[model samples]
Target: MINFESQNLICRFRGIVLQSILWNNDVKSTKYTIKEMIAHHSCLELPEGKSITKADTLEDLAQLYELDDYYWAVKNIHPLTHDLNYVL
Candidate 1:
């Protein structure tokens, strides 16, 4: 696993070319923060001040995604937006 400093954060989204198997809802395939996506798909909790390492490049993200089905293309988004969504 790549070690990451908390200063840099990365996100992901399912590639448009991948077909959604379940529903016709394309909304479910929209870009999502990697942290949120991982939290939902795995029991592992991200460290309090750590983020995915080597996620700075698309190649890295693709390799990470290949390791597990939880990842997708790299996306950059606000870290706190997940919490704000819950509050709103």
Candidate 2:
């Protein structure tokens, strides 16, 4: 079990490193726009919740924005924006 966990961690780390390298290359090449990056990150489906309804109120709007920001920060390669050191 420990071996499996270690392997998973290593794989995930490699993926992150690869993603960072790709992002760096994109930044250098100017091939990827910030909007495209944001859109890519926002493609994830939110969890089932009443706050996600179309008829949601202003409070829901705030919550939704917060959720999007949190999701982007977590999925982003930058360490400063991430709340935790490790990926979820």
Q: Please name the candidate that would achieve the greatest lDDT relative to the true structure.
A: 2
The TM-score, computed over Cα atoms with residue i paired to residue i, of candidate 2 is 0.26
Which residue pairs come into collision in candidate 2? none
Q: Candidate 2, residue 82: CA error in Å?
A: 21
Candidate 1: segments with Cα more than 4 A from true spot: 1-32, 44-51, 67-88
Clashes of 2: 0
| Most TM-score-accurate candidate | 1
lDDT of each: 0.33, 0.36
Q: Give the distance in Å from residue 69's predicted Cα in candidate 1 to where it truly belongs.
A: 17
RMSD of each: 13.6, 14.0
Regions of candidate 2 where Cα sits further than 4 Å from its true position: 25-88
